[model samples]
Every structure is written in structure tokens, then in C-alpha cells.
Target chain A: MRNAANLRVQVESMLESRIPSALTPKIKPPLESMSCGISDIDRFKAFGRGTLVEICGAPSTGRTTLLHGLLAQCTAGGEAAAVIDTSDTFDPVSASQSGVVLREVLWVRCGVPRNQGRALSRLDQALGAIDLLLQNGGLGLIALDLANVPIRDARQIPLSAWFKFRRAVEDTRTLLVVLAQQPNAGSSSATMLDVSQSSVEIEESDKPSVEKHIDGDCLIRTLRNRAEVLRGQMTKPVRSVRTIGEFSTSLYSYR
Target chain B: MLYAGVHLPNFPAQAALRNDAEARQKPFAVVAGTPPQVRVVALNSHAKKMGLWVGMTKADAETQSSVKIRERLVRLESLAHAALQDCLAGFSPWCEDVAPDLFVLDISGLSNLMGTPVQIAKSIREQARTFSLYIKIGVAHNIDSAIHAARLTKNVLVLPTGGEAEILRDAPLEILEATPEILGILHRWGIRRFGQLAALPELALSERLGQEGLRLQRLTRGISTRILSPTVPSMAFEEEMEFDHSVEDLKSLAFVFHRLLGQLVLRLATRALAAGEIHLTLHLDLAADGVTAKEPFFTRTLKLPVPSVDVTLLLKLLQLDLEAHPPGAPVMKVVLHIEPMRPRVVQNGMFVPQGPEPQRLELTLAKLRRIVGEDRVGSPELMDRHLPVPFRMANFTPSNSPSRKLPAEVSQTAVRIFRPALPTSVEKVRGTPRRVRFSGKSYQVSHASGPWRRSGEWWTRGHWGRDEWDLVLVSGDNKRIVVRAYRDLVTGHWSVEAEYD
Candidate 1:
């Protein structure tokens, strides 16, 4: 070890002009990461501030569940979060069951009566609300829920508006997550994910079935979505192997 | 006790133009009477120079194109007077409301906090200027002397002990507000100035003017003494403005609201307070045909989730409110009243993660409320009920989110609820649902669980009974999905309630 140290010092002295501190390793500050309350998804990379993420899935595909989990993670840690629900379909009961601090979340429900025409107005209002919230720049998380919004209605939103949202939240502490049925943010989103029920091979006991596991009865049990996440884009440099992320965890503790 | 008296000169005229900086620069007269009987009750210095005097008919005043005429607003005069007392009360606690235009404060102990007598008097004059009152301040060793000295001075007069009598000698005796009979007797006695009244023999004056004579003598001499009748400071924060022309556009009202809210904020801030709630009353001008509502005032109340002193934010809130529920008619006058509260004092922890700033968040929330309906934007609070999806929206405040100790890592499950549970057609055999159709798709229930019975509120009109089940449905393409389905026993209807991912 002494001889190696001497050799290293001699090599550093020889390479001093070409490379300063050749023997020392440069330290980089660790990226500030936020958890979406899912271990499989969080392991890939540290998702830091100043990024837009999109969670797209079909109905009953754990999209709302994952959004609530992100909200729960954000609010339980004393950070304020907001949800711009374009369809006014947020369930506070399920969110509370998921450990989301309701008081910490600002819910802007842009739902209009069905009798009231102009489905396009709801989308516009939601987008305008997101812009306002972004311009003020303080919330830790802002989730725009377009899950119930029809594809035709959601597509009416101009691409430039999405880019504006991306630009507004850039380099800020806000983690803007857009929840839609399909990819609407396109290239503006930093992290893109597609979720569906996992096709995990069932055991012999429940052959050819998705094998339902019922904890205690709804008599006194909670409902949670255990969706399999297929990551589309990530913030880190590496691609996820198989992309089997725990996008939404199941909280079957109590009803 | 050393007393300081503040007297507002031409108060009615000043009050009529207090809110209008432009009108204050011109000749203005406030006339009060019945119709053609209307006469000039008060006139500004400019109006006085233009030959406008008290009791001059409105027609006579209108003859002078240079003089602006306004109907006397007793309300404004009272507001100005209260504002003056509020200003003086800030300098000293013991303030006596001697008259509408006159007030005296016992400034004996204020030197420690406000400095010397001269400084207090100058500060009083400056503070009163914000309320748009032209004031004359008098600081003397006695209350009556201070009152008389205040009446005699153009601005501030600090009279030493025994010096008020000499300074007030040249002042008009009309400041006493004597009766006409006494005025006639004083006129007959050739006593036009206080010096003549003070020089009269006390015994002889009592013989001619009765007991009122001796009292007048001491007051004229500026040697009078009396207890300061201090009034209880009323906690009221109100500001109002009347426009020359009825304002029809909301944007135009914004200009008026901005100015009024600024004054209210300044007054609240001076008292170390903030407005917890604001009530705006816009007096509307009805159509000449009387088609509009008889109640001409359109009222709106804005309750802040967090009391704030940010004038811009308050103005934005008012603007948003006015835009949302506009007074259909033109607004002729605006009255703003606020419920004062101590501004929130929060010492954020250095390690705590940042939340949206309280004030900016409010502004953003207000803007969001404008886009969304008023009742639609807020925090969702779950209500305790037997019904499915029970919750109400609550105003969001930064402090509402509390810090909690979290485990090293937490992963929780969530369910997506169908706001209006999707209606479904059930294919049942022997009281068992074998298939379901919803959203234009038919699904085969390959695996199903027992019905979980939920029933409550049996005594109320909204009583409900439902049997819920977890169904694992397989689509045509072999795509599997899990959903919670329910059947309302009361209606015997089946619906897909929520989905577990």
C-alpha cells in the first residue's frame, strides 16, 4: 500500500500540468428525488425538481390511484400539492385511505353540468388554472387529471399550451404530473408511463384467472390498486429493464 | 394635563371631496336642503373666494361656473370625522370627540412614545392629511385653551401656559357657537372679538347674558378648564367612494376598488391588523323605467381563508368577485367594510419543505375560482356519511397541511372512483350476475365475490341500502379488469362503482 501511494503521488506529479488532482475523484451533488410511493418505479432514477411527468392509462388502470399516491407522498411530508380535476371525479375517501393529507391538497374541479354545453370549456379552464398555479410557483406537486376527459376533448388543448406548462415549471420545485388516457403532452413531458393490470402468471390454486386476493371483507378493508407500470420515459440515463415498476401500490389495510 | 385639540376646518366641504383628489383642487360647495330650497351649507376656500356663502341657493352657486356643487353626504362627513379620531387615537389613547369637526386629546403621556409636543402636533397634522382633512392642531396645557387655540390657528399652534388668552384675543367670538339672542346682546355690547368678551367685568356680563355669560367669558379668555370627555374607540374599518358618473364596466370599477382597498389596507396595517373578511356594497343606478330591482345596492362578501394585508391580492380578489357576480346596473357608489383580524404570523422551519406562499396562493386560488365556479375550487374534505363519495370543498390554507412523521418508505394503494357510478346492465341467473354491460362493452364476470352489504340512514329521507361485489371481468380480447360493482336494493339497479388497479 505504501509503495502504491508513492507511485500514485509520483504519477500525479508527472501529470500535474495535464490533469489537476488526478488521484482524487470528483464529487457530484446527489439529485433531489421525490417518491411516488412506489418502490419499483422510484428505484430507476432520482426524479428531481423542474420536471413534467405524464401518467397515461385506460380506465380502472390505477391512474387515479398513482396520482393519489404521489399526492399522499407529497402532502404527508408537509409539502402542498394541488389537483386540477378536469372532470371533478377525485375521491377524497380513497385518497384519505391512501394517506393523502386532504387539507394540503387544493382541488380545482373544472367540471360543468352536462346540460351546460361546451365540453371544451372544461379543458380550457383546467389548462388556465394550471397556468395560474404554475406562474405563482409554490406548490410541490400539481396533477392535472384528464383521465375522465374524452380523447377528443383533451386533444382540443393546443400543443403550445403544453409547452408553456413545461416551460413555466422548468427549473422549479414543482413536479407537474399530467394524468390522461393517452399521451397528450407528447414531447413536453420528462417522464412518461403507461399502466395496466399486471399479467403475472397466476398460481395453480386460481388457474387461468388473475387470482383475486381479498383481505378482510369490505366490511372493514381498504381498496388499493396494484397496477403494473410500463415506463415510457425516464429522467435518468439508463432504460428500465422490462419496465416492471410498482407504479401504484395496493393499500388493502382497512375499508 | 397637556391637551391637543384637532379641528377640521370646512369639514363638510372637505368630506364631500375627500376621496376625489382632483375635485379637492377646484372650487367645491356642498349644498343641503329640499330641492329648490337647497342652499350651500359648506364651501371650500376656493368656493368662498368665488362668492359662494352659506345659505346661498343652489341656483346662485350654479350661476358661478367655476364653483362645483355637490349634495352634502352626511355619511362622508361622519366617516371623515371617525377617521380623524382613529388617527389621533393612534398617537394618544385619551381622545375626546368634542364635536364632529373638533376633537381634543390628552397628550400628557405621549411624549415618551411620540416625542415632544411639537412633534406630536406635526405628526397629527400629517396623519390627518391621509384622510384628506384640512386640520388645525392646538397644543396647550388645558383642554378648553387647546380647543380655542385650535379654532384660531390655520395649521398648528402650540401655546404655552397663559399664552392662549393673548393669541386668541384677535379670534372671532362666533367660534363659541353662541345663541342668536346672546350674539345680539354681544353685538349690542360691541363685542365682536374674544378680546372684547374677555375684557368685560364678570359680574356685569352675568347680569346681561345670565349664567351663559360667565361661561363664555372664561372660554373667550382661553382660561376655561373642563374634564376631557374621551370616547371609546370603535373598531370599524370602512371606506367608501361615490363616483361622479355611474360606472358600467367592471374594469372601470377596478380603478375605484384599487384605491379604496389601498386605503383600507393602509389603515389596517397601521393598526397591525389584517382584513379577515370584506363586504362590498355597490349602489346601483336603476333604469329610469324602474325595471331593475328596488334594492339598489348589490352586496358581495369575500371571506379570506387567511387574513391578509396584501393590497394587490385583496384588490385582485375584489376584482374577481365583481367579475363573477357583476352588478347588472351601473355602480353609482361603492362602500367597503372589512372585519379586522391580526395578520397571520408564521415562522417557517428552515428544514421544512416550502409550500405555496400564503398570499400568492390566495391570489392564485382566487384566479382559479374565477375560471372554475366559486364552489368548485378548494380542498376536498370528506364528509362522514353512508352514501358513496361523500365530501365537501373547503377553503385551502397553507397551514392546513400539517407535518407528520413518515416511515422510512411508504407505498400505498389507491382506487379510482366513478364520480357518478357508471350505470350497468346485469345479466343475472338465480340472483347472481354472470355478465355486465357498460360503456358500450359487454364483460364476462369469470370470477366474482360475495355481496358486501352497506346500508345506513334508515331514519332519514336519504336512506340507502346497497350490496357491493368485486368482479373480475374478462373482455373479448382476453384483457382482464377488476371493478367494484354495486346493486341498489331500493331501486334494484346495478352499477360499476369504482375500479381497483
Candidate 2:
């Protein structure tokens, strides 16, 4: 290790006038990450503070579950958070089951019918709400849920809008997470997670675990899913030791 | 103890000037009582020059060419009285509400902080000008002497202590505000000044006018020993303005709101209070239309998250709300009322986490409500019922002290609910095998859960019963999904309720 350090110094000194320490790699400060309060995801990757994150997946792929986990951790730690539901799909019981303090969350539901012709359309209104939340800078977390929106409509959102949101939250402690079926924030997202259902091998004799006498109604089964980090902080992805994360859900919603 | 008195002359005319610039230049006369006996109770100098005396009838005052005759509004006078007391309270706390337009304060021990008596009186006069009132101030050794001195002085007068009687010797008898009967007798006896009234034989005055006559005689002689009656600060905080030309646009109306909110905020700050709620009323100009509209006023009330005296924030919230629900017609008058509250005091700990600021969050919610609908922004509260999707929206108020109990390491997965459940076709084979189809997609039931029965609201007109099912469906290509499905017992309709994540 000592010989390698000496060689790097000698090479940088020889190329000082030409490239100004061209052999030395530029080091960046480590990004601070807030725990999602779930070992399944935290073991692999955690969303960074003062940065934009995106969670995209197919239906029933644990997209909302991950967002709820992040919110629960934020609220339980004595901070406030907000969710702008573009499709009016936020379930209060499910969020409560996820351990989120309901009082600490500001839920803004976009229930207006789609007025495509108007300048301030449904998507624009949602974006405007997010902008307002960003301008008021004390919230710990803000999630924008656009999962149920059609991809065709979501693509109409300009790249400049994402850049604007990224700039707004760049240096602040607010962590903005966007939920959708596809990564709509383009390159502006500091971290993007692609999710899908993780297949579990089950033998015919090995039936799924079910609660027999407790709930007295529906049978419960454990559902599993996986997430892969598509992009993240630290110019190179070498700092991340784990690449994929696996998590599960309850079949009958004990929540 | 040195006492000070501040009195508003011609209070009825002054109260009528609710920021009306024309009332100061033009002749103004305020009348009271019913139709036959309505007489001018107060008149400005310009009105006095136009042959409009205090005893003239409203009709006679109208006959004078440029006289502006207005009815006496008790509300305006009360508000003016409140403003007068607020101004005096800044100089000293022990102020007495003597009359609608008169107040006296005990300025005995303010020498070190407020300099001499003359300087304190000068400071009070400046405060009255900020309140849009023309007042006369007086300082004397006794309450009655102070009151009479205010009535006699041009602007301000401070009499030396221990010589109150000599200083007020030349003041007229009317300055005492005595009973009319005693005044008539004093006039018949050829006494028009305080010096003359003091010289009358004390025994002869008591025998003729009884106990009341002696009280008046002593009051004029500046020998009053009455204690000061403390005044309580009023809770009402409101400002009203009437425009000569009706305002039709929101942008123009915001300027008016800014002006009014500044005054209200300043008043609250003077009292060390904050506004907890705001009530606004816009008197519409519906008289211009040919049709008769019974309700011509548009009103809106906003309850703030916390008590705040921030003028910009209050104005922004008002502007946003007015933009959402505008008045149907042009507004002729606007009244803004505030509910006062003690300002919140918070001692923040160093280890405490940061949250959304109450004032800015409230402002953000108002802007969001304007963009979305009013009912779309708030915290969600689960209803206490067994029915499907039971919940209500409430205003979000984050507690300062968060729950100390932390969540477990492993999180419970949440489900995404479809607001209106989608209808689907399910083919059941002996209640075991099934094929579900929805939104032009087909799925085979790889595994199925039992049918959970749930029902509620049986006694009301809206009754519901459903059999819920949890199913793990697999497509032809092996893509899998888990969803909650329910069958309505009344309509026999099957729908996909929510997708488990």
C-alpha cells in the first residue's frame, strides 16, 4: 500500500503541468442516507437525504410499500412528512399498519377529473402542489405517488420539470421520492430502484404458511419481492456491496 | 399622582371617518334618533360653517348644499373607543374608559422611562394620530381636573401639581359636563365660569340643588378625589372600508386586504396577541343588477394552524382563499375580523427533529387547496365503521412531540387501493377453480383464500354486504399478482378491490 501511494504521488508530480494530477481520482463526500426502517432494503441501499429518489415497478410489486416504509421511519423519528397522491390511491389503514403516525402526514389527494385542455391540468396541479411543498422547507420527507397514472400521460411531463424539482431539493434536507411504474425523472434522480415479484420455490407438500384460528376468515400467505439499484450516488457504484434487496408482504393484509 | 386625559372631540363625526378621505375636507354631520326626532348630534367645522348646527334636523342638514349627513352607527363608535384605549394603554397600563370618546391614564411613575409629563403627553398625541384620530390631551393632579382640562385645551396642557384649582379657574362651566338642571340654575344665578361657581356659598348651593349640586361645585373647583376605574382591553379586532367605486377584480381587492391586514396586525402586536382565526365579509354590489338577490354578501372564514401575527402570511392566505371562491358581484364594502389569541411560545430542544413550520405549512396548504379542490388537502382519518373504505379528511396539525415508541425493524407492506373498484368477470368452478378477467386481461387463480364476510349500516338507507376474497393470480406467461376481490351480495357484482404490494 505504501509503495502504491508513492507511485501515485510520483506520477501526479511528473504530469502536474500537463494534466494537474491526472492520475489521482477525485474523491467525493459520502452521501448521508436515512434508514427506511426495513432491514430488507436497508441492508442493500437506503435513500440519501438532500437528494431525489425514484421507485418504479409493476403492479403488486411493493412500490407503495417501500414509500410507506420510508414515511413511517421519518414520522416515527419526530419529523413531519407529506404525500401528494396524484391518483387518490393512498390507503389510510395500510399506512397506519405500516407504523406511520397519521397525524404527521399531510395527504394532498388529486381527485379532480382530467381536464386535458386547460393549461393547469391534473398533472400540472400535482406538480404545483409538489413545488409548494418544496418551497416550504421544514418537512423531512415528501413523496409524489403517480403509480396509477397512465404512462402515456406521465411522459407528457417535461424533463425540465424534474430538473426543477431536483434543484429545489438539492441542498436542503428534504428527501423527495417519486413513485411510478417507470422511471420518469430521467437522469435527475440520484437513486432509482427497479422492482419486481421474486419467485419463491415451493414444493407440493410444503404448503404456504396460513393462520388457522386467529383471523377466523381469510387465509394469509407471505408475498416476496425484489429490488435492484439502477443508479445511485458515489460516481462509481463500487461503494454498494449489495445489488438486490428482497422483501415480503402479507396475503390477507393483517394491517 | 399625575393623571392624563385623552378626548376625541365631535366623536360621532370622527367615528364616521373610517378612512374616508372625503369626510375630512367636505362638511360632515352625524344624526341620531328616529325619523321625526332625528337631530344632528355631531358636526365638523365645515358643517358648522354651512349652517348645520348640532340641534338641526336631518332634513334641515340635507337642505344645506354640501353637507354630508350620516346616521350614527354604534358599532363605529365602539370600535373608535377601542382604538382610543389601545393608544393610551401604550403610554400606561392603568387607563380608565371614562366615555365613548374620552379616556384617562395614570402616568404617575413614568418619569424615568418617558421623561416629563409634557413629553409623555406629546407621545400620546402622536399615537392618536396613528389611530386616525384628532385628540386633545391634558395632565393634572386629579381626575376631574384632567378631564376638564382636556375639554378646555386646544391640543395639550399640563398643569402644575398642588395648583389645579387656580389653573382651571378661567375654564367655562360647560367643560364640567354637569347636569342640565344645575347648569340652567347656574346660568340664572349669573355664573358661567369655574371661578364664579367656586365662589358661590356652599350652604346655599346644597339647600337648593341638594347633594348633586355640591358634587358639581366641587368638580369645577378641581377638588375631585374619585379613583380611576381601570379599563379592560376589548377582544374585537376588525377593520372595515367602503370604496367609492366598487372593486371588481381580485388583484385590486388584494391591495385593500393588504392595507387592512397591516392595521389589524399592528393592533394585535400592540396588545402582545396573535390572530388565531380570520373572518372576512365582502358586501357585494348586487344593486346594480336588475334582479333582486336576497343574499348580497359573500363571506369566508379561515382557521389558522397556529396563532400568528405575520402580516404577509395572513394576506397570502386571504388572497388564495378569495381567488378560489370569488364574490359573485363587485364588492362595495369589505369587513375583516380577527379572533385574537395569546402568541404561542415554544422552547425548542437541540435534539428535537425539524418538521414542517406551522405558518408556512398553512400557507402551502392554502395554495394547494386553491390548485386542487378545498376538500382534497388534509390528513386522512380512519372512520370507526366496518364498511368498505371508511375514512375522512381532517386538517393536518403535526404534534410537536412525536411518539417516543419507534417502529420495528421489519416493515409491514402496504396495499394500493383503487378508489372505485374495477368490475371484473370471474368464472367459478365448484367454488374452487376460477378464472378472473378485468381491463382486457385474463388471469388464472393459482391459489385462492377463503371468503370473508363483512357488512355494516344495516339500519340506514345505505346498507351493504360483501364477501371478500384474496387471490394469487398467474397470467399465461407466468407473471403473478395478488389482489383483493369482493362480491356484492345485493347486486351479485364482482370487483377487484386493492392490489397487495
* Candidates' RMSD to native: 6.2, 5.7
How does candidate 1 score on lDDT? Answer: 0.78
> Candidate 2's C-alpha lDDT?
0.82
Q: Taking the tens digit of each residue's C-alpha lDDT, what string does model 2 give over B159-210?
A: 7876777878889999887889889998998899898888888999999989
Quote the positional error of residue B305 for candidate 1 in Å.
1.7
Which model scores highest in lDDT? Answer: 2
Q: What is the C-alpha lDDT of each candidate?
A: 0.78, 0.82
What's the DockQ of model 2?
A: 0.43
Candidate 1's displacement at residue A119, Å, is 6.9
Residue-level error in angstroms, candidate 1, position A144: 1.6
Candidate 2 Cα misplacement greater than 4 A, ranges: A1-29, A113-120, A200-220, A234-242, A252-255, B19-27, B33-40, B43-68, B185-191, B195-217, B238-263, B281-299, B326-336, B475-478
Per-residue accuracy of model 1 over B330-420 as CA lDDT, tens digit each: 8889999999999888887877888787778888887787778779888888888776677888888756345565523344445667767
> Clashes in model 2: which pairs?
none
**Could you list the chain B TM-scores for each candidate?**
0.90, 0.86
Clashes by residue pair, model 1? A221-A254, A221-A255, A222-A254, A222-A255, A249-B413, A251-B413
